[model samples]
Every structure is written in structure tokens, then in C-alpha cells.
Target: MKLSKGLLADLRLQPELQVPDAALLALPEKVLQFGTGVLLRGLPDFFIDKANKQGLFNGRVVVIKSTSKGDTGGFEKQDNLYTQCIRGIDGGRKVSEDIINASISRVLTATTQWEEVLSCATSKDMQLVISNTTEVGIAYVEESIHNNPPASYPGKLLAFLYRRYQHFNGSEESGMVIVPAELIVDNGTLLKATILQLAAYNQLPTDFITWLEQHNYFCNSLVDSIIPGAANIDTGYEDELLIMTEVYRLWAIETDSPRVKEVLSFAGADAGVVLAPDINVFRELKLRLLNGAHTLSCGLAHLAGIDTVKAAMANDSMAAYIEGVMLHEIVTAITDKHIRHDAAVRFAVAVLDRFRNPYIEHKWVSICANYTSKLKARVVPALLQYQQHTDHVPALMALGFAAHLLFMKSPAADDPFAAYYADLWTQHPAETVAEKSLSDSNVWGTNLNTAVPGLTKTVTNMLLALQREGVNAYLERVAAEIIIS
Candidate 1:
């Protein structure tokens, strides 16, 4: 049987599945979503669906497929019904749930149904706007909102808000809570700034700008979940929009507005939705531990011929290396006066468990995308901070750094960083490559060798050792040294 709204009655009889209440179908469209990607569907929509099922937030989503790549036939065929298979370890226990998410009421392509999408702006029920248009999608572009469907995400959003402003006569009560789930820092702030900039470029009225500034609430939000889509899983029924996500989920929204809190009543229904004045701790924990660990270990794991994160975790030496890097180095550096030490340790342990999730096939190569930039942003800071605190080199970090350089020896032609390094190695000798790279201020923001004493020597030695003894043997030696030290 296919997963569709028509099959909901029969699906309800199944013991393994959780079907949505028939009453939820009539819920008013309250959320204006800007993406049809699985992350948004699996995380935000998942929470909204859970809230609606419990009759807390009786709201449905009107999704705008901002891009013109895929058709909305799947959504139409299924009546906007999709299966969410939650499979992962949570609090050291296995969790598995099959939920038929009915959050999205309809999917409209922005290019074809611009007027219909604009019509959503006038609805009193539409009090929330959410977007997940990727990292680049939140950029600033000087585009006029007068186009049939504005060129950029911010431009489209400006047009929508302008229509709303016109419809409500700049009423304060008609303002919407905008939350962007893009994986960028201050996503909401940047998005709001871009919208205002676009408004200025389009020569919008001063009263409309004042209404936008005083009435609307833009919340910076951070989302954490591994939604790898449903292409690999079988759920006993065909579903075009099936999504698989980890049981662990977090949607940290930064806002103190009473109205924002009131409108987001769904937070009361789920622990996953956290409303806070600041989400920096959550952001730092995630960026440094989970994402940073992945950045540091990915090169070494890939060079060791490990295919997936789970596969690397299965190896004792590789797993130990990852743990040591996070707990001993990254966690230690991140746990300062602002962050609690115990909390950072717990988060690092959880990250290790997530990495060992057997169901998730997170490939090392995928983590190695834009390896140089990731090293600078995620790994280098920890290295520098650890050095500052301890006045000693982080051996594991050095090993990871060496492995990254080794990995970049023959990088893809398109990767400018890798290509630059390749050219550097071609011109300079192996012994000098570490010093050259470590001193490249353009790459690391500052000369790494000058910042961390003996860093260049450590990396050079590790690079030579890796080339000679292989990653496994080198990791074993590092592990033995850590034990002795």
C-alpha cells in the first residue's frame, strides 16, 4: 500500500505506525515554510506535526518550493503525507518510531504559484514563517520585490511581507514570527537585515519599515538532526516523501519576545523545542564537539580506508583517537568560563555515541567536503585555545592536522585550497610543507607556528610518520604515547 491520506484509515489499524488524527486535516494553515528539503520536513515539520496531533498547535504548513527543480506531484499524490522513520540511540537506549507526518497542508512552487503564495500573506492564521534554504540561501542580494517571484530568498520574503503589510495596513497585531533554520550564525538577524535592505532597495514606504521593525519578531534558531532522506530504507509501503532521522532532535530558538513564545506554543508539547534568550552554548557544543570532531577525524578516517563514521568507530584505535580528540582536546578548549566543563564532557560523550550510531551511514568523504575551511573554522580555534591553556601541543590535533595535509596532497581540481596546497607541496619539499602551511596567515587567519610553539615540528613529524607507518600504525603509536603520558 502507498502512503497517502486516503490510506490513513487503514494505516491507523497498524500497530507499528502512529497515524495523525483525522481532525488535524482541517487545521488552519499557520506556518509559511520556504523549503521542501528533508531536514525541514524531518525536524521543524516533525515537531509541528507532533504538536498538532496533541491538539496543542493546530496549524498546518504551506510550503513554498523556492527552487524550480522538482515538481509537487509527490506532495499532491500523497496529500502532503509523508512517513518519518526515527531510528537512533537516545540516552544510551535504542529508539524507533514510525510517524506519518501531516504537517504540510500544501506545496506550491514559488515560480509558478507566486500569487497563491502571496495570498498566504493576508491570512490571519499565518503567524509564523520558517525557512531552511541552505547556508547560501540566506545571503544578501540587491533585488527588487516587484518581480513575479523575486530573485532571492530575502527578496521573495520581502515581497511576501510587503503584501502582508499592505493587507493589514501595518497593524502590529498582524505581525508574524520569522525563524530561519539555516546552519549559519545569526541566521534570523542576517535574514531580517537582508529583508530590510531589500525593502530599501525596492523603495518601500517608511511606515512599512517601521511596522517590520517594531511588529515582527525574527528568532535565530539552531536545528540538529540527521535526516538522510528515505531512499535507503524500506517502511513496508512506498512513500515519495519518506524521511529517516535520528531520534535525537533539537530546535534551539533564540528569542525573548512574549508574543514569539506565545505563538510558538508547540514548545510546551516537546522537549526538543527549546526557547532561550541565548543558544550560544548549544551552538558552541554542536559546532565544536559534533561538527568539529567530524572535521578533525574525517581525513584520518578516510585515509585509513574507513568508509563510514560507524565503520571508523568500530575500529578500536580510530574510535579512541576520536574520543581523545574531542574529550581531551576539543572539549577542554571549549569548556571555558562561559561553558560548564561537565556539560561539555557529557555533550562530547553523546557526540561519540551519535558517531557510533549503526543505522547512520555518514561517509568520511562527505565530511571532508571543503576540508580546509572546516579545519580553519572548526578545528584550528580549539588547537590554538588548547595550546594557550596548557602551554603544550595537542598531539591528537596535530595528528589530525597532518592527516588533513596528507589527504589534501592530491585533492580534486575544483577544491582551491587543496589545489593551492598541491602546488605548495610541488614547489616546497615535504619537510618544509608543514612550516609553509602553518605560517600561511591567509589560511589560518594567523601564523599557526607562531601561535602554537612546536606545532610546525609536531605536524611535520606526524606527517612523515603517517606517510611511512600508515594511519592505523600511527594512531596506535599516538594512543600508546597518550597512555604513557
Candidate 2:
């Protein structure tokens, strides 16, 4: 049978499967969501569904399809009902469950239904606004909010807020909690700044601007979950909105406002929703341990002919190399006065476990996307910091660097870093590649050869060794060097 509100009572499902209460289906739509992507559906909508099932947050979501590429046929067909398949390893235990999510009440197209989307501005029940419009969606564009549908995300948001300001006569109680789940750092601050700039560009009234500044709560949020979206998975029923995600979830929201806390009372029902004055620790831990380790090891794993992260973890040498890099080098380097040593250690251990999860097929090639920027941002800082603290070269990091150079030998057309290195490889001699790469200040932000005493020599030697000995034999040698040192 197809999953929908009407089939909730008749369907005889397993005991582990959670069906939403019939009463909660009649709940008021209180959240104005900006995108229909799986990340928001699998994380925020999942949390909202959980809370509503427990009768804590009696609210539904009104989703706005911002883009015009896809129609709302699937949502309309399924009555906004979907299945969430949670499959992963959490706390050293395997987790597998399916949930019928009834969080979204309706999906409206922003371009055609602009007035309907704006109608929520006058709704007293609409208390929260959430968005997950990728990393590039928060930029300031010269757009007029008076357009039926503004061009940019921030512009669309300002138009909606302007409607609310006009509807309520700039009342304080009508303000909404705005939380953006974009991966950029300080997303809320940047988003609010962009909205203010757009308002000024449109010559908005001073009183409405003042109301926006004083009344609204823009909470900085960091969300962590791997939602790979619907794949070829049988759920014993038809579900067009099926989304697959890991069991481990986190939504860290930074806010100190009493009204904000009161409106987000759903935090009381689930441990995954954390409200704090700051979420720096969560951000740092994710960036340094999970993202950092991925950036460092992706090249090496791919060069070793490992396709998926779980496949790399299954190989003993590759797994050991990943563990040593995170636990010994990356974790130690990231732990400073602000981060506790024990906390970093715990996070690193958890990261290793997540890597070994059998259900998540994290592709190494996907991690290698934007390779140069990732190395500069995620790996290089740890490499430099490790040298500063220990005064000894990180053997695993050097091997990873060598693997990156070799991986970049065959460049993609769009990748400028790979193209530059590929050109250098064709023009320069083999022995000079490392020196030239280390000295390119434009790439590394500093002359790595001079910044770290022996990095050039170490990288050059490792590069030569990798070419002569191949990836597996070279990794074995790196493992032996770590053991010996």
C-alpha cells in the first residue's frame, strides 16, 4: 500500500516503525521551510516529526519549492507523507528503522504561488523559518523585494518579512525564528546581514527595519547528518519521498533569547536538538576530525583503488593509516587551550567508528571534489600546527600529500589546481615538482618549503617512493615508519 495519512491506521507495520498520531495530522502549519531537499527533510523535518509524534510540538511544515527545476508532483501524490530509512552505526551499535514522516503539510511553488507563500507572513502560528539552500544561496544580489518572486534567496526572504511587517504593523510578537542550515561558518550572521542589505537596497521603511532588527531571532545552527536521498531500496510500499540517513543526528542551535527557547520547546523531547549560547565546539569537532580526516585520506584511499570509505576501512593498512592520522596527528594538533584533549580524543574515536559504518557508501572521489580548497582549509592547518607542537614531521600526512600530488597528475578540465599541477608536471622535471608545489604561495598561502623546515624534502622523497613502489607497498612503508618513530 502507498503511504499516506489515510493508510496510517489500516497498515499493519512492524513494532519498530513509528506511525504519526491521527490527531497530530490536524496540527497547524507553523514552520515556513525554504527548500525541498533531502538534507532538510531528513534532519530538521525528521526532528519535527519526532516531536509531533510525542505530542510535544503540535506543528506541521509549509515547504516552499524555491527552484523551478522539479515540480511538486511527488509531494502532492503522497499527501506530503514520506518514509525515512535510518541505517547506520551509532554508539558502536547497528541501527535500522523506518519512520513514516508526516511533518510537511503542503508544498507550494515560490514562483507561481508567491502570494500563498507570503500569506504565511500574517499567520500567527508560523513561528519559525528554516532554509537549506546550499552554500552559495546566501549571497547578496541587487534584487528588488517588490518583484513577485525575488531572484535570490535573501531577496525572497526580505519580501516575505516585509509582508509580515506590513501585516502586523511591526509588532514584536509576530517575529519568527530564522535558522539557516547552510554549511558556511556564521551562516545566521551572514544571512541576517544580507537581508538587511537587501532591505536597504529596496529603500524599506526605517520602522520596519527597526522591527526586523529588534524583534526577530536569527539563530546560528550547525546540522550533522548523512542524508544520501532515496535510492533503489524496497520499503514494501510506494514512497516517492523516501530519504535515507544515518541514525546519528545533531542540530546545534545558538540562541539565548527566552522567547526563542520557549518557541523551540521541541528541544526538550529529543537529545539531538541542542540549544546553546555557542556551537563552536560542535563546528570545530566536525571540521577538524570528520571533514579534516576525509580531506587528508581521500586521495590516498582513492589511489589505493578503494572506492568507498567502508572499503578503505576494511583494509587493515588503510584503516590503520586513517586512525593514526586522526588520533595521533589531527586530534593532537586541533586540541589547544579552547578544546580539551579528552574531548578531541573521544570525537576522533567516534569519527573512526562512523567511517567504518557499513551502510554509508561515502565515495572517495566525492570527497576529492574541490580538492585544492579542501587541502588548504582542512588539512594544511593541521599539518602546520602539528609541526609547531611536536617539531617532528607527520609521516602519515606526508604520505597523504604524496598521494594527492599523484592523484592530481591527471587533471580535470574545471579544476584549476589540478590543471596547474598537471602543466607543471609536464613542464618541470620529476624531482622539482615538490619544491615548486611547496613554494607556490598562491596555492598554500605560504611557502610551505620554508614554513615547515623539511616538508619539501619529505614530500619529494615520498612522491618518488610512491611512484617507484606503488600505493599499497608505499602505505606499508609509511605504517612501518610510524611504528618505528
Candidate 3:
């Protein structure tokens, strides 16, 4: 059978997918999730769905899409229904499909339902507010309260909190615990600060500020999952592609918010999510192991002419490049005990296995976008830490950085790196094409153009070779120079 809309409906109605209508739609209204993106569906929705099935949180999740560009017709068709496929990696084999279990209760485009969304924020039973609106979503805007429609994430949040403060008549119990999985350092604190900034800018009441500070709980969280939102099997069910992520999903909430732990019952030998004393440890591990390796591998994989991450992993040389970059370069730079040495190695090995999961078509583009932003998250920390501690740049991290620059300069068809670096090159456009285009210190942040030992020279030589030879030849040279050396 076809996994069409009708077929999916039948499947959801089946005993496994269907909890009693009462249980599924209990209207606890506790989960006010922002962003209808796949990560939220795959990560939080999966957990909430489990909690519902096991007679835990009776609340139905109400979703709000902060952006208007997401699916409208598809969400309208099924009353906001979709499927999440979980594919696990064990040894070298890919597991079977686990789909259709986690589906949305209601999808509200906040543009149309701003009032409804705000009302939920003030609802008596509402307790947990979750968001995944990308890193750029968080900001402070002055007109948050004055504007009929809020302009930014923090703006909308502040307005909601203000309303909730009024609705509760300053009751402390009505306050919520906000968890935003934006992969930002100090996400919760930054969000709170932005909200406060908005509050002050808008001249909101002191009572509201006091309520926000006193009652509300904003806990930082680190969420890691390879949720590549590209559906396979061409069902043509909706324009919104189904998402497949590794079964190794993890949620690390800060040591505080013990209530979140109790409410979710998230504890076990392999419970997947952990409540950590310092969420930063888990965050660093994710950045260095999962995200850093991914950033280091993307252009390399594309340069070697590979499509998906799995295919890249299948190619021995590409796989070796990934492993070597992690083991030699990136891992050497990590400072945290939880994320350094053996721990980093174990995580890197797991990430490799995740990369090779055949069931999940982890698209290069999924890991490819926000290259600059991702570098900040993953590589820059290690660079700063290692430089600060050792007082010398590590070789592997430098090599990975050089490799990123080299691929960016390559002018090859089917070159993913070309498009990635197009903007930077277009702005700079290597003067004379003979002298290595990116000699500009701006791109490298420092005079890394000349400062980092023989990096500029090495990268320039590789770029020249690529122009003359090809990606394969360039890879051979890099593999010999960086990987072998």
C-alpha cells in the first residue's frame, strides 16, 4: 500500500497510533510548541507522543508556525497531520522504518491565529513552552507590545507572558517552563534577556517584569538529532517532505528544571535524554562530535562527488577523511573532560555510524546550510579553547579549516562547495586568479591568510591543483598532505 493521505489516516486510526480520542485530545494545552519544523516534530513531538500513549501528559500539543512560508495546503488537508520516521544504527546495519507514531494535534499559522496562540500562552493548564525557530529567530524588538502582530520571537514571547501575567491575576502556578532547542549557547538566558529587553523597550508594567523574573522558568537545553527532513519512497502525500532522523536522539536539559525531568520521566540506562548539571558539556559534545564532524565532512564529501552522507561514508577515502578530521584535528582541540579525548572519540564513532544509516537519507544540504553559523557553533569553540590552552593551533582543526577554504575556491560542476562559497567569492573574486582568491583576512577572521603557519600556502596549492586537475586529484593531494601527514 501506498502511504497516501487516506492510507495514513487509516494507519493513525489503528490501535497503535490511536490513543482514545480523550487521551489524544485531552486539551491539557500544556505544550505550546513554536515552529512546525521537522526537528520539533521529530524530537519533542516524538517524546510527547510517547508520554501520551503511556498515560503521562494528557495535554495535546498545539503547534504554531512562526514563519508563514511553511506548508499550508498539506497541513490544512489533514488538520495538521504528518509522519516522523525514526531509523536507528546498530553495528553497521540500518534498522527498519518506525513511522506514523508522532503526528501533530493542531497546526496554527501564528499569522492568522496570533490571538489563539497568545491565549494558549495564558491558558491555566499550560506549563511547557517549546520552540525550534532556527537560531536567527530569537531577537529583541521594541514594538512587540505596541504592534498588533508581534515582530520577533522574543517580542511575541514577551507579549504572551504579559497576557499570561494578566490572565492569571499574578498567580505563580500559572507560570511556564520554556525550553527552546535553537542550538544556541545560553539559549534560555539569551531568550529571557531578549524578552526583558523587549519588555523595557515597550514600557511594559513592572508587575509583568517581576512576574517574568519570579515565576517563569527558562531552562537551557541542548537537543541533538540527525533529523534530515527529506522523505523517501515518493508518496506524494504532501509537499512537506517527511523527516528521517537517527534513533540516537538526545535532549540535555540544564541541571535545574527537575520538574521537566519528573513530568517527562526521562531517565534510564538508554533513556536517550539526560538532565545534565551543566548543559554546556552535552552542548560541547554535540558541537564537537556530531556537528563539527558534519561541518568538516560536508565540503569534503561533496568535493569527492558524493551525494548523501551514507554514500560518502561508503566511499573508503571519504569515510577516512571524516574519521581522520575528527580523530586527528577536531578531537585534539576539545578541552572539556566530557567532550575530550576518549569521550569525543566515542561520540565521533557514533556520529559516523549515524552518517552511514541507510534508512536515513541524511542529505548533504541538511548538514550543509548555515556553514558559517555552524562553524561558529562547532569549530570556533574548539579553536578558541585549544588556542587558549595549548597556545598553538592544533594541526587537524587547522587542516579541516583549510579544507573548508579549499573546497570553497574550487570551480567544479556538481560542486556543492562552489554554491556555498559563491557569495564570499563573488564579493571578493580572487584578484588575478593566480594568487589564491581568499587572501583577504576578513574571511579567515584573523590574518589566518598568512598567520597560520603554512595553511594559506597549503590551501592555495590545493585550490590551484583543483583548477588544473579536478576534485579527485585535489582530494588525493589533501588526503596525502593532511590525512597521511
Candidate 4:
């Protein structure tokens, strides 16, 4: 008997990987990914992995972590390769699969090796740029300039594009299509605007702007995939990069041209990324129905003393509370009639199932991040929408917001849920929940408490109940008065 010392030998599913060594180790870099986080690794790499398996793209990807806090040393240590694991129902059976991603050739972090990053940017083979630096990660800092050693994401992008423009003497053929997977409204357009701002601030040549406008492709897209990051890389899953995720994936792109199809074909993602004229419609629908449910669930479940979604759903009363929040308060609030109602319901149910996936250990603390901001993006629209259709207050939704306000008022951690509200109420003393709501315009984009009749009273009452009886007990009172008939 003999033992192989190869790092990948012990991996349970390594034998299933069919990545050719030539494709895995040495292929022309056609993509420069700006962020090497879970989304790109899971979604885009899944596409590339499929494409390679189908013999569509033998091309390689060069991943660059475009932030000071992010480092690719771990990825590089694994030879710029990793695994993507998907777990969910497939054909009504619970199935899981592990994929060895061979699309990546190298990893570079801007802080440590800006030269390497810039060099990849200058390379003629690099044709596409993908990024998911999160919603807050893509903002422009006016002070950022080209003179800095390592710049902001847009600044770094600008430097890269300038190099590419100069590399081939401003040839239109050298220009690349950039698709950023940041979950912003019109992310590509916003990204290009920032890059153009950087160009103007740096006072780059007018031709550069023209080149950017004429040659480059900045396509807006919506990407959805639940990718749970590694608990610990050192977990004894040797040769296995544990990226737990749901089977669901979406990439809605706004581009009419054949370029997307061509690139998708070239990258082996022809099956995954969908091209449509109105990606925004789908984006809004998903954000409202899917993301909305997650936010409301957190507030409602937390008030019931339910920590994990699975635990929350196990309680029939809490589970019904979530459903009522979605169907009555949330879904009823959406103004757009075109959003598939049946699909939305199914999606909500699917999200619940995902939340209950026994193998996945999702902490409320993680999903509970950005709770205040999420309420605006996720829950409030439904609130406004419901009011528009029917002239009555959504009491359950009001109760959820009340839970959020009380949760904010209480001692809470700095996760997304508590941070903004904590900063708002704690920093500036307000006498009542309504006063807090009225003061923080950022939460609702306006004083919605005044606009919606009886909202403040409802929230105030709910807040009082929570304070007097504690969270779970208060929720029982709410269920008695609001949920239960």
C-alpha cells in the first residue's frame, strides 16, 4: 500500500473534478476579478467551472482583492484553487455537490502587491472585470487620487483602465466589459460614474474619457446566491474549501448586445447568466420579496427570542408571524403588479426552507447586520406599497418596525441590525420611539411615521409592550391581538 502526499489527495470529492492541469495551472488570464469574496468564488467561478467542464472556456481568471483588509495569501497558498459546495433540494431530493474551481490562476491584493495587480490590469489577455465589494464598498472618496500607493476600488480600476488604454495605444479592441456584482441599483452605471469622476479629478486626457465611453462596456447586473463563508479554513476538511451555499443562483444582466452571450460562452456561464432588457424589474422584485422577508424575519423572530431562523420557524406561532409579515405586510405593500405573485410566494417558502436547512448553521447575528438600512431597502417599500393599495395600517409590519426600534433602544451589538439605529438614538437623545423615528430621516428617507396614519401610535404601543413584558412575552401579546384570530 502506498500513500500520496499531494494536498488534494485526501479530499472526498477531488476525484470528481475533471479540471485539466493545463486549464487549472496555466491558461491565459481573460478575467480580472476585483473582489475575491464568497459571491465571485461561488457564482462566477461556478459558471467558469461549468464552462471548463463543457470545453467552453479553457481561460483562466486572475483574482485581485481590492481592499486593505482583504488578503489573497490563503487562496495563493491553495495554488489559487478552491472548492464550491452547494446544498439544497434537487428534483425533490436533498442533494449536495462539491466543485473544484479551476478558473482562477492567481490571486493579488492591492495593498501588498499593487504592481502585480496593475500588471494584470495592463495585460492584453484580461478582457473582463468582476467585483462584489458589497454595497458600501463601491462608494467614491473625493480625496482619493492617482498619486496614492494603493487607491480606492474605483481609483484602482481607473489606474488599471488607463494602463490598458495606454497598453494598446487606445485601441478599441483592448477595451473590456466590466460587470460588478455589487447589489446596488445600476451598479455598473454607478461604477463607471465613479471611474469617470476619478478621471476628471485626476485630470486625465479627454480621449481617455471618450475611450471609456466608446470602448468599455459597463453592464448592470443583479446576482443572488447564498454563499456561507468558511467557519475556519483550518477545519480538517483537507484539500476541501468549504463554501456552503443554496442551490439557487441568479445573474440578471441588462445588455442587448451579443457581447454578453459571447463572453458567457467564452467563460462557460451560458446557462447561468441571463440577459434581459429590464434587469431592474427582476432586481426590485428579488430585493423586495426575498431580502424583505429576511429583514422582517430577524426583527419578528428576535422579538420572540428565536436566535436561528430554523429555531424561529420551529415555533408555529413565530413561523406564522413571519408569513403574515411577508404576505400581508410585505407582499401586499409592493406596488408593482407585474412581479409574479406565485413565484414570490414560492420564493418566500424556499427562503424559509433554506433558513431551515439543517446542515447550514446561520446565526441571526450575521443576517441581522444592516438591520436599519435593510428595513428601508427591504421592509419599508412593502409598507408603502401596502398602504397605497389599501387604506389601512399594516399592524404586523408596524409591530416588526417597533421590534426594531425597541431592539435599537436596547443594548445591542454593532451588527448591521443595531449599528445605525444605535448610532442614531444613542448619539442623539430622543424621548420617544416616534421622536427617534421622526429624527432619523435616513431610516425611511422621510418622516414616514407622520405620513402613515396611526403608525407611530402602533409602534409606540408595541414598544411599550416590549419594554413592560420583555421581547418574547410582548410577541405573545402581539400574536394574541394581531396574528391570532
Q: What is the C-alpha lDDT of each candidate?
A: 0.90, 0.87, 0.67, 0.71
Clashes of each: 0, 0, 2, 7
TM-score between model 1 and native: 0.95
Per-residue alpha-carbon lDDT of candidate 2 for residues 1-485, written as tens digits (9 for 90 to 100): 77887788865355777777777778999999999999999999998999888878889999998878779999998889999998877778888888889999999998899999999999989899999987339999997887889878898899999999999998999898999999878899999999999899999999999999999989899998788898667877789889898877889999988999988878877888999998998898888889989988998988889999999989888888998898889887888987898999988887887888888889999999887788888888888998998998877787778878888888772356878989989998768898898799899899888888888889899899889999889888777766666
Query: Ranking by lDDT, best first?
Result: 1, 2, 4, 3
- Could you estimate the TM-score for every candidate? 0.95, 0.95, 0.78, 0.80
lDDT of 3 at 160: 79
Better of 1 and 2 by lDDT: 1
Residue 334 CA displacement from its true place in model 3, Å:
0.9
How far out, in Å, is residue 274 in model 2? 2.4
Residue 195 lDDT, candidate 4, scale 0-100:
87
Off by over 4 Å in 2: 412-414, 480-485
Q: Candidate 1, which segments miss by more than 4 Å at Cα?
A: 411-414, 481-485
> How many backbone clashes are present in model 3?
2
Q: lDDT tens digits, residues 83-154, model 3?
A: 566676856676655455333667777677788878776667778788988733877656747455586778
Using lDDT as the measure, which candidate wins?
1
Better structure of 3 and 4 per TM-score: 4
